[model samples]
Target chain A: MTGGRLAVRKTYKLFIGGAFPRSESGRTLELEGYNVARASRKDAREAVVAARKAFGGWSAATAYNRGQVLYRLAETMETRAGAFAAACTGRREVARAIDRVVWYAGWADKLAQVLGSANPVAGPYFNFTIPEPTGVVAIIAPTEPALDGLVARLAPAVVGGNAVIILASDDHPLAAIELAEAVATSDVPGGVVNVLTGLRSELAPVLAAHMDVNAIDVTGADGDVAALEVLAAENVKRVVRAREDRSPWEIASFMELKTVWHPIGR
Target chain B: MTDLQKRGDRSPVPTDWTYAPAPESTDIVRLQERYGLYVGGEWLETKDQFTTIAPRDESPLAEVGQASEADVQNAVAAAREAFKSWSKLPATERAKYLFRIARILAERSREFAVLESLNGGKPIKESRDVDLPLAAAHFFYYAGWADKLEYAYPNRSPKPLGVAGQIIPWNFPLLMLAWKIAPALACGNTVVLKPAETTPLTALLFADVCRQAEVPPGVVNIVTGDGSTGAHLVRSEGIGKVAFTGSTEVGKAIQRELAGRDISLTLELGGKAANIVFEDCALDQAVEGIVNGIYFNQGHVCCAGSRLLVQESIHDQLVRKLKRRMSTLRVGDPLDKNTDVGAINSKAQLDRITELVQAGTDEGAELYQPPCRLPEKGWWFAPTVFTNVAQSHRIAQEEIFGPVLSVLTFRTPDEAVEKANNTMYGLSAGIWTEKGSRILWMADRLRAGVVWGNTFNRFDPASPFGGYKESGFGREGGRHGLEAYLRFE
Candidate 1:
């Protein structure tokens, strides 16, 4: 009975606020012989709404708490690394992607000390600077090394207390949906890491112009980054054009420096 | 009567106390009849020129050149050429140039201060005490870092980004120029700087100081113009980094213009800051903090505490005290050392402040401006306070970059935090409380970049200053400021 039975195919859909829902437009793009959810501008907007809703609690969470959740995310990805490998390019890439997530996971609590400083400001004042999240960040995930590039960009942003709405790699979006499945099953909260599989040209501009979105990482942005930058300027959004490297500075790029001063008085 | 004023402490005033005239002599600054653009270490003239007036008396100070696209291009090319040598100079040599500039600025501080107050309409006290000293201190602070770049950022080699294009605001003209030029120069980058149209004198004066310091040609170029000139400098092909300090509107425009270009940018934009007063706070000290927070420099500060959030229990007492203190603030000739509030920067700025104040009154809030008379001819706005202001009021929400303060009441710390952050801008916030734990708590919760606890409007060269949201990005002071001018290898 088992030998003749047909295997059911997976219906890839958009991950919005942690839920695997089909795109509101009910559109799909054929890629690698699979139907992937083709997200609309409205879908990108909804993702931002969800991300904004999650921001207050997530950003307020202690760095230690954020670190723990990110660590759990790595563990969840490791368990499903085989599936991730099958969806993306290869096993080496999936392994690197999962390892990169763990690397960023460790930086969640340590970024403040490395990136922030206490100032000996020449006054009777105690001054210190700390890095705070830049709120909802929109990540344009890269195409090649799909899983690794997305994790490299996504982990740093999320680790620093920012909620993300990622426009997954347009060509290799299956890996993104698969990663979203792992995110849903992990300790990461809903709306924390939203995945939209669609045309970068269609979706990137909407996210760039969204007023609620505080920062953008265009590491994966393809063609006319200037146009996207122009849209990002409407809100004075922090535009990060970073390389695909795993560093605390990548996390710092999405964090704002907040310096507090108090007079040392009796 | 408004709700809180009914219960406000209405103390009687004595009539006899008044300060004697103490005007700083304007004879110290001998202004030239005409000034040209400082390009490639030379004063070059342009056919297009505009007269810069002293806002204090609307007297034309000097005719300064208006930089055209060609002028801007020439400036950029000069800066680009200079970058080859400047960026290659030994870091120690760079440090020496900066140290010399700092010393010369300190030596000529009074002349620069007089010109700053005369041109920018800031009080002599601020231009003399706050602006000049801080401007000199910024160069001194970044000067030490020039030779010590490796110690600033570990593991990464910090190198200068070439040909920084800097645009500064009318407020604190010399100080903003110092902020822009010091770090760029300390990092071994050549710069083409555009000072604000109304207050280009100090910058052009500082150009003379650059010459005295024997800085190489093309190392620092001063192009004086309005926004169009700034736009040209931002879009120029040779610039590797752009740093601006002004309105959020212009910052966004610059960001859009530089979009897709492989150039770095840092913006010190606008702020609508909140100064929160707790019930248990030291009442007299809090009053002083509130007055200094918004009234300092005529509230032209990017981090001005324009919104005052008071505990509902002490709203009456605090507002009454604040008004009493604000009344004593002399708003008169900027040259008068006794003047606390000074002239508005320009007619356009005065119109903006007037329109916003009118909007506050029309929206049914109570407005209070003390019984001090403004001088007849010049642009002036009195130290203003608005009560019964809702969080949504235009006065409370917008960056009224003048001596205007909008006071809103909050019943709890959470409510105070909620209302404090309910703006598109988050440049700075202030907390007035005796309790140490509460100050830390409020500081943690406030979304602004700079938070002053039990004190307000305090800046130091070592303290990093910038904003969180639309108030713009990157810091201007301290170790973090180095990151903006440096490229990592």
Candidate 2:
């Protein structure tokens, strides 16, 4: 058996509805002698459905519960640190990606306090501005620092209570697939975070034009952000274009500021 | 319940309840021949003109200037010119101007309230109690924020975006103007605001408020017009930001027009808000919320709860109670202090509501109207409710923008969320449940920007307001509101 020298290769399948499934069209692309499922508009469509289905449950989770779930994601990612390190450009990037997840996990419970307000209106009323998740955010993940960039875009949206359907980096796909593996093992609910890897061009437009999608994060659309923004405007989807700072405001950009007024009385 | 019962034989008969004629006097509001555009702290000359007629009685209130292209250009230029001094002023000084405006509005509150009811066709009680007070509160709220922008959004310095172009709707005309102008002024941005053609008087009166407060020249300008004039101002030169509160159709059009432009836009548009009544709700209060949700402003509110989703267990009881509560609502003259529901804002809006109500009837839904008499001449729609309304019915799907509620039943919490968020518009929603956990769950699931736990149609100045989806974007009212008019470094 030792002399047989059998070969075992990894199959990079798209993650949807918490299941690793091959492309519906059975399309494949070979990058550096690796077989990767080529995600189609249909796959993006399926991810959006899954994300939308998961949105109600995931967004309804208490902030503390969500924070714990996201922190669990960081723990799972740490256990698979070696795998992520092998797939990514460096061990430092994977380590930083884990740290970034921890960063967002901490923000899950605290960001609301930072972003929300108890407004003082001149009336017999209790007024509040609470940041709520804009549902089913479709994100186009960044190319450079594949593992870290992908984590940066994914964390804030989910931390703020949105379900995400992200198009993984077209140039560097292996790290994203590894990250998806860690996500499946984490406490994140099925369909809460769906990762599809393939042609960004074919998928981004469909996601942008998707009526079910409430927002589009074109932070990694490369040159297609302007076009995607216009398409998003067709359905009035909130468009968060590529920007550097991953501040709390980045999460606020994907969140709806809901101001509630209740009459002050017994 | 209290209003009618206090009068005597608290029988639920609609014919028995006759409200005393408590008409608010309109003698206080003085009108001009042709009110030209307010630009650079003065009335600018304009050739084009149109008459602003009262929707309650169809009498000409004033001959308002129809802003020409040149007039739009002048307004933008004036705002741009003032932006220099406005942005350079100290935050405390800026706060003073807003405080002055708020105080002036309060001192002359009754006059403004009367003008608002006459021009917008809202009940005098609402104009006085809701619109006028909220308008003053908006300016007052923003005035405090003017000097404290640094504390509002921690860890950042907020810089004012120059020369905002604002356009408001006919519903709560003065209130919408306050929502638009107050925040922009607080953030140190000079504004060129356009009031809706149907109701420009209160805003033109606001221009007078600016003068009385001695706000610097060109700091605030009011350009009156229909949609075309609004279009010109939107595309006008030197407009760095645009804020509009109107119908979603116009909001999307404006979004398309402003796409890829550097200008930032905040749209407060239409809604088909779902008023969800779960099994455990306080049924009587739920009935009151249902009536207030749809019948308020004659259902002209963008955040109005027009879709009623009652739990199947409470369906019959809730509908019966809602119908009874609606029957008590007095609908007639806008100036009448006793009126609960008033005339439709325009003939076009009234016709639209009529056509949609007809579609509901055609779609096999049961229609109910209280046997109340509307004023003889003006545009009016009775407080209407459709029972057995399918989620796909036209009345359920469209924003009729009049006093109409579509009643549908849901058996489960999941189904209720599904039906509530079924509309393309997600402006506001109401959840009526006594359970603490369920309210949190429902508020989480409901897609609306503003979710009322047990109340409906409640608004406050400090409370940021807007929508989630096709109901439009950006917020106006709190710290989030200032971001619409400020550029962050």
Candidate 3:
């Protein structure tokens, strides 16, 4: 038993409302003789519909419930480690991706504490500021270290109870689709995570400027930073600039300040 | 003449004269009817049309489809139809489309920049360095928002406001398109975009880019024409929201047009931005801001620092330095790599700028110009700065959309804020301060959409940008930017 090696199977499909399916577009992109899945603009829109459907219930969930779901998602991702690792070119990268999930999973319960604090206003009222999750986040996954970078960028957002529309790296998007499958099996709600794999240049602007999306993560772009910043300003979507040297502790990038005021008399 | 000689000695001129390449132009008739108006994933043609001319030399650039009343009706109808289903889509999936669009825009950035310069009469360096990159970045930045609205404005549920009618100015044509269109799309609202009349070619090219990205038709409908088409789109009953970037007069007109109507409006209108220099500020940095403020885009910007408010203590010193700087400002063909100032956007804009410069001289203000030759055929203006300008002067009150700076002096910080806020427009303002607390204090009091501390005219997608008061309402960057496109659920 100690000498034997375990074999794992990999499945790549579009994730919509926590369900895995062949793209509604029924499209597949080819990379290195492997069939990578893709979703059409319509499929992408459908994913958005699915996330919108799940938004109320998922967003309405208690913090405890959201944390539990995120924790369970991390656990499920751990079990699919072999598949994800195989999808990547190296084991070190896959390990980092799995570690990223766990790191962010822990953040589900702790983000409010780390990114938020009680605000001492000039007035005499109970005011405490906490961090909240933006609803649906559109992400451009890193182009180079596909799986690890994608996971690192996405986990903080989803763990915070935000749904995600991620245009996975076109060159090596299979890992992202496979991760979507893992998320489906996990306790994450339906439409909580949607992954689109195709030409990123073709897909990013649609996501960047989609009115329904709340924030954009441009950490995956390999080109001009200024132009991307300007485009993101169109609807004033919160943008997270891509940083190659940042670490997992950079989870604060997905956090937003939320001030809550209540009457002390109550 | 003695004052000019005195001012020349204090500030030295910049010696750099390198310029960038110009864009090639094609016949307008060939481009007009051939392109389809993108609406709801369908390419449709309009019965009405208009021709666009290059402002550089009065040459035809492109003939664009003028959205017929019927075409506008159909596009809005499609947007309304899509809104039912599209708005209902999960925020995450909506985000995917935006991400996809961002990616596509990045791939075709070079082509967009070249086309933008060719159509808009902007320099190739500006189109490449400032406009195209920012245009693509706008998409990338907003793409991430598809699924993140909840966190943007906490407590309240953010929703899509359906179709957005977006009209962009010609100053930074493609960049403005990104500014108006990206967040609208990200928020799940379909759009009918109108590029300026003088610069419709790049926008038409963007339509091609949208098609390549497979952006569903009716999702982005581009109808290119002048103010009439824009007025039609703004007043159209089908549009739920309107976003415009243009002159203050036009913005007020648009505001009146939407009054009493159930429409959300975001106006990024004209600005007479003040670039204030204090005695304590860094001279080199302030000089750079001065040049960048008024010289970038050949001062065709609404937010260009047309008013240079220098501290009375530093007035003589700064003016002397500025005149020396002005002497080296290369004024020539926009296509020449050696030219610092490019061609003016249009004859109308040129006439307006020249008229204002003339008015400054007519008033008590003394005019100063560095030795520079103006292009004969095309619309052009040398970088001119007026001194001894009073706050009450027309040159100080009105926006001169050209490479001209009006110099004035303020005795105190209160005066700086008072003079800065005196204008009807409040798009942007710049303060040169060494003290951190003073920067914060001034930023709090400034009514402008954007306040630049230490630096001027800097922009980021993460940082919210927009104006207050008559300059405009609503924001165009960061999380505040999304509010214009989203509805509260």
Winning model by TM-score: 1
* DockQ-based CAPRI category assigned to the predicted complex of candidate 1: high
Candidate order, TM-score descending: 1, 2, 3
List DockQ, one per candidate, in order.
0.85, 0.51, 0.01
Estimate the lDDT of model 2.
0.88
Candidate with more favorable, higher TM-score: 1 or 2: 1
Provide backbone clash counts, one per model: 0, 0, 105
Error of 1 at B335 (Å): 0.9
Candidate 3's residue-wise lDDT over B387-419, tens digit each?
A: 989989999999888888899889899888888
**What TM-score does chain A reach in every model?**
0.97, 0.96, 0.86
Residue pair clashes in candidate 1 = none
Q: What lDDT does each candidate get?
A: 0.91, 0.88, 0.73
Q: Candidate 2 has which clashing residue pairs, if any?
A: none
Q: How do these models rank on lDDT, best leading?
A: 1, 2, 3
Runs with alpha carbons beyond 4 Å of true place in candidate 1: A1-3, B1-16
Model 3, runs deviating above 4 Å: A1-266, B1-36
Candidate 2 chain B, run of 10 with poorest lDDT: B1-10
lDDT string for model 2 (B415-443, tens) is: 99989989898899998988767877777
